[model samples]
Target: MTRRARGLSLLLLLALIGGLTALLWPAPPPIFQTRTMPLPGVLAARCDEFTPRVEEPAEGVFVAIGYDLANTIVLRTSAGNVVVDPGMDLARAALARDALLARSPGPVLAIIYTHSHIDHVGGARAWISDGPPPQIWATDAFTGHFIKQYEALRAAESRRGEHQFGRSVGPELLPCTALGPTPDLDHAGSTGARMPTHTFSGLQTLRFGDTEIELHEAHGETHDQLFVWIPARSVLLPGDNYYAAFPNLYTIRGTSPRPVRAWIDSLDRMRRLAPEHLIPSHTLPLRGRDTIAAALTDYRDAIAWVLAEVLRGANAGRDVDSLAASIGLPPQLADKPALTELYGQIDWSVRAIYGAELGWFDERPEQLYPQQDAAAREVAMMGGPPALLREVEAALARDEPRWALHLLAKLRAAGSPDPSPELNIRALQTLGEQTHNSNGRAYLLEAAIRLRRPVAPFAVAVDDELRAGLPIDLFFAAMGARLMPERAGAAHESISVHFRDTDDHYVVTVRRGVAEVVRGEPLPGTPTPLASITTDTDTWKRLALEQDSAAWALLGDHLDVDGSLLDLRRFLAYFRRGA
Candidate 1:
């Protein structure tokens, strides 16, 4: 054939391929096409008010009134009662259990946790009484994940957790709403979580008498998260997966990177269920399948939209800060009552997505090396402490409470002497009242209280049962994040922690001002460990948790030390206690 004829034939073939690709390109998932429904404008205004009221959405399912930030769901199945996510602590859990039993009296058959979060599982003990305990059910990852978070960051989390839940502020200053009637700041680390008798990985159908409940694992807020579907009642309990606010894609209190793609997919799965009733761990239940569907669809789209915008900017080589500043939810989704930013802000979600995709680095060369705290350094350079105090006063005078707080923080970090503690306290109080986020408000209030008066030492209250049950590896892992690199001194040291009870051994290494904990015995060819401590697990827990002083432990001869005792003392000194 002639060259021109051959070219024409090839063009035709290419056109045919393009046509097939277009046809099979898979239409955007139905969730993406969901139209935003108008929500009641008053809903946003009343979102924060918490008035506990028990309601039965289904024939046998009873939800204890919103007592705190979390809800307890009780299902009266033919076999017995199944409780999902008992409240945050013993008191809260007991309250919920009592309320549930009042409505439907029956023996507890099963207890299910949506995720490993303390608020969801911390009240598990409330369900147990003299009778045979319910068969606890949770995702297989729940216990491990729970141990990793609470054991490692208990102190730091407890401190920040108070602020996150607005426990520092009084009802007169910051009225509690979504966090229940009263926020228990002191018991943030209390772990009432019971061991799951039965654990499952993916989808599992459970039988509670004649009722069939389906559990599906979906990673959204937490990796161990699972949602329940009572097919018999056409009811869906999404736990934290779907609440009456914008999803907390990124919690400011700090968390492992939440899987956005998986979260969106989870929503899709819930939508597919077409439940006539939808109940979340937080907030009120929704009735009608269409309403539940629309709510879920809108929520999924909101998350998708934010993720897409972040990705678009990320792919364009724009930095995270730029993406966060520019990306926002479309007006339709933003205006929806169910998609409000009452709990989780939109900007935070953007930053979280960026961090999840690209990590802590913003692709800037300047960020490669560790730098001193920029805010502190700035305060120091700009006329030192007095100048910053003046600036803070000026900001407060202009009703710029947030700016004033920021300035005061910088001044405090710069080691400035307290020039006007009362004034600083007032400024913080003002800022706390003005902020909308519960966590932010709590932080400001707590700071104010600190400035005005002596603050108590932070303590983590973990029950003996819970502490003893945690894996030895988790204890070491928690230490890794709490290491105070600045206090390590100019020394390279390594120590092996041998738990006599568990027969678990780990090597804790301190080098270049950072400490890392590794499981198993020290590796060959590594620097010789300076010390090795052979101790029972309980003694180790006491030492690590700072419940017992290191000096006391050493003096009491609770642990056997090999090699330089001085080195071990110095190594233990490297971590900040109750940080």
Candidate 2:
């Protein structure tokens, strides 16, 4: 028990602990390895559908398919040509326009937009002839719906859209987009877009030249979607409703809840029409009334059945995953070519429906608050990152790519890069190649590519024409979304924006943690703002998107600042480019 003896004993104990720690330490993750597999055969077959050709199913009706993600249909008549859903951008639309002109030549009297999706309407200008501009048509809800999407979520959707469409990946990874070839976004400028000059609700019939068409407001893929019905020819143009694939009840790219019930109703309504010639905005047209009817019937039933099963499962207290795994299309529907999961998978639909109806809570108390840190601690307790990496490899070998991905994700989150991104890339590629759903495959492959090479965040281009159409409110909303509370800190300030062109005024007040936007002039009793901005919509958009520097804009007189330049810069600093 002497002091010297005690010190020697402590040193011996410390050495013993060190030796045990060394003995129990985990091995490093396996050397990064992967086995490349051929892409699925079904996907290749699906790609063949987008072969870039124009087909005429009915007299005076020319459809330019495979030219873009969506088809451009030309309804030729004595009066003029009526263009429907004009492809994605100017370049593609111009090609389609020339093809239609070669076959059925005439000035485009009217350009009918089946929906407000950019793909459907971005090529508006290309369809117009060298005469007075055509009257653009769309559902009344189109503008509001489109604006809502751009409000605060534009940047997020832009990034997700890139993945969903395989923007960065090569053709070997993604032969074609699920709907068609990847959209020509590079040439997709606002110059081609034309807002609806004529908006309608419910149903409206137009009789021009020898064509009599009915525009029925059918809510399906989008709230503002409509179907163009040619009564004289018994031709029905269902926009994104009945493609030759399982309907995308849920798109991998994030979206607001698709109204499944409304979608079913829309299909049923189409069935009642009993059109002999059915031309979808994507894919080839179908002939024969019975064949078209049968396809429409099966498509609707599949959707209805999935929705019912999801609801039934939710009511029975089953979790979302269980419902997604169990619910699938009946064999009769699944066997049908039109109902194949080429574009949309049934399981994604099931989860989407379940989540849309009942929020994210899975009813499991443990899931209420995620235990990410706890999971990392547990991983450390269970032989650490090396053991988890081994499990990931085992899962990959066993054809459980999803499980492998899960393990790899946990390892990455635990701050262990030993396994390397190569393992994650392999798992993602495996999943991507195996899945029949083209969108899913594109997203997976793009994600894998991202792990290998990080790219700049995708941002939707805003041209002058597009900027003019966008409301000032959207800029404010995006500002709020990009506001960094930490950057604001204890700063409490207010800035008023006045759009000279639109003659609109708005006020933005930034507190410590939140940014509040108010339309119109500030209340009478409110304190004066720190800065007041006077600029047109385009200049503001440029500043907001980081396309133009605020200091440069101010110097160029694009922006007129009433307050101190330093204060203006500080106010602008609170909002980052993208989240």
What's model 2's TM-score? 0.88
TM-score per model over all chains: 0.80, 0.88
Candidate 1 residues lying further than 4 Å off, grouped into runs, are 1-49, 151-155, 186-191, 316-319, 360-398, 402-427, 481-501, 507-518, 526-539, 542-579
| lDDT of candidate 2 over 389-411, digit per residue (tens) | 88888888999999998888777
Using lDDT as the measure, the top candidate is 2
The Cα local distance difference test for each model comes to 0.71, 0.76
The candidate 1 region of ten consecutive residues with least summed lDDT is: 16-25
